[model samples]
Target: MVAVIKSSASIKNVLQYNENKLKQNVAQLIHSGNYGKDTEQLGFTDKIRTLEKLISLNERTKLNAVHISLNFDPSEKLDKETLQKIADTYMRSIGFGNQPYLVYQHHDAGHPHLHVVTTNIQRDGKRIKMQNIGRNQSEKARKEIEKEFKLVQAEAHHLKQAYEIKPVNIQKVQYGKSDTRRAITNVLDVILPTYKYASLPELNAVLKQYNIVADRGKEGSQLYNSKGLMYRILNDKGEKIGIPIKASQIYNKPTLKFLQQKFLQNQTEKQRHKLRIKNAIDFSFVKRPEQSLQELINALQKERIQLVLRQNDKGIIYGLTYIDHQTKCVFNGSDLGKPYSANQIQERCNQQMQRHEQKLTQRPAFKHANEQKQSALTTAEENGITFKIPGVKEVFKELIQTEQEGSLAAELRNDELRRKRRKKLHH
Candidate 1:
């Protein structure tokens, strides 16, 4: 089983999240702790009043709400009773057994997961120390519960689902084709909690894969000034379409402020996965030494690592962001090191192309001799006996240039050179 623990200032938000899910019939209140009646039988007001009453004991603890989720492998066939017991045991192990927490069994995703909502404030007006709770207590409890229940271990479970990111097909959110709010929300529900991205661009690199983009509006705009955010669907051409969904309106409230916090948290989280990307890139090159830029992209994609190239209107690639699906990590090329940066990647591709080009152009003395003989054999009447013997090398060179100069790859190379020249002039 995998576990995620989060603390929030608004217990209502946490409660309402589950409440909304319950209303949608995607979740059910499974068990209650430290309550007189079963949690499933309690009304919304009763559940809120009971938890808030305890939170009011300590005004100093603004973030009193604790939300935890225990995720099981998709193959696991866990009944409600077993899930409740697992939640109960996991909570007790994490020192939340005495708290008036409620467990809700969620059936939204492909996996079997349970959401536990509770408070950290005690009846005596004392607040529980939540620092390192997830890394320390929750991890310990998750492993223990997995063993006790004979369930899939976290490491094993992740490995099992590593390369297979989304088992069920989730079509790209197209404007007007579906509910915009729900479509973006569904994408966020899967992305926000899973991928580790430090910045909006890095996050967007992953979001663009699902045809969704998080828009903070233009600089100096009202939304930008107010630090507001919106999620919008992108068309096949990558243009934004349809009405945008406010970040706050989303179920988990992935606001700009919220994402800023995540940016900090994910920076450290993303570091551990950098080596995986670096290795994958190096391996791709090793696998195909003569591969072009497009071939490299294909090789990386085959490994479930997306190599997103950021290019200008001129089609000059200026940036590279790698998305590792297996590890759920997004990393900029610069973050990986100088070798993986945009400049280096372009230089490498050009050099590889140059090498292959050289190999194809290089000719031994015998070939040159044969070309001279063939040139001599040409007769004026036969349409060969050149009026002025043209150099075979120059003839072939012009033909190669004619073939390459107008090619798409050559245009990209030209843009890259022009960009580099512009930078040089500016510097």
Candidate 2:
């Protein structure tokens, strides 16, 4: 079992966050410790008020709320009772036994995890010093509890998922270059040799989360030809800051040579993840058939795959890369298939645009035809023509009027002929 903890100043926010999961139906309140009632007896609002009242005792500490999540192995299928016991024991072992903490079982992720919401402040208003609490207290408790509970021992491979990287504020790092270097180093130390990436852009997509970039000079430049690379801290805008640090200067020596070897190895190692990347891409298009390139990128990002577009100097996209962060696999778009290639994707985007534009243009023609039909019906009513006959009533009315006029002209000719004969006889 792995324990992850985060501290916040707002008790309401942490309580609402866990309760929101309950609203989503992906979580359940399993155990309420040090509370008057059982988990089933207490309502969500009551739970929040209970924790808040405890935090109110210590008005001096701004960061009083403690949010901790304990993740078990995906292979472990512990029942609610077993999970509750483990949560209670872990809390007591970590010295939060007396504090009022709400235990919630979250089912959103693949593993069985529980979220504990409690405050560091005691009922007597004394603050629990949380300095090194995670390293000193939580780590020791996690090991002992893992053994006692017979849970899967969290291997090194599971460490990254257990403890996520904390993001550094880019704006703050600008004040000191060493802080930027140290921050970059901290991230690279974990990601450089671990995550399988084939190219620089794929690596950047992963580094982007930590506000760091591994940059090679412009194409055909001395640095690019020499296969030299440098690392730089990226600001909020994604622009580089401070002098670029050479890869060789870093203790790990993440040079181009080192990265190239990783690229070659990743080519073979990342094959296992190709199906997952393909499925994610296919699923995105199925969900939103008319999605633009940017929309597709957003959708894939939710699936834990970062799609990076490679463009030329003229701003024409020539290639595509997908960084599957979940599997730590990097694949070139062409490597996936011709369908995932840049040209093919651009074609799909164009087809979607054309379909949308065609619909927009066809709307006016359809509206005009409907309007003309309505106008014809209104004119027929104004001219005393009934349209109930349905078989071209206007044409039938014109034919009837022509026949009646011909018969009347013939009758008037006959009367004129009679009048002429009578005048001749009188003369």
Computed on alpha carbons, the lDDT of every model, listed in order, comes to 0.81, 0.79
Model 1, residue 286: distance off in Å is 4.8
Per-residue lDDT value at 376 in model 1? 39
Model 1 per-residue lDDT tens digits across residues 82-182? 98899889989999888898889998777888889999999899998986687799889988888899998878846456423341122433324556787
TM-score of each: 0.70, 0.48
- Estimate the Cα RMSD of every predicted model relative to the unseen true structure: 10.3, 23.9
Question: lDDT tens digits, residues 237-268, model 2?
Answer: 77888768898766446778767766886777
Question: Stretches of candidate 1 above 4 Å error?
Answer: 1-9, 22-27, 36-46, 49-80, 93-96, 106-113, 119-178, 272-276, 283-287, 302-304, 363-427
RMSD of 1: 10.3
Give me the candidate number with maximum lDDT.
1
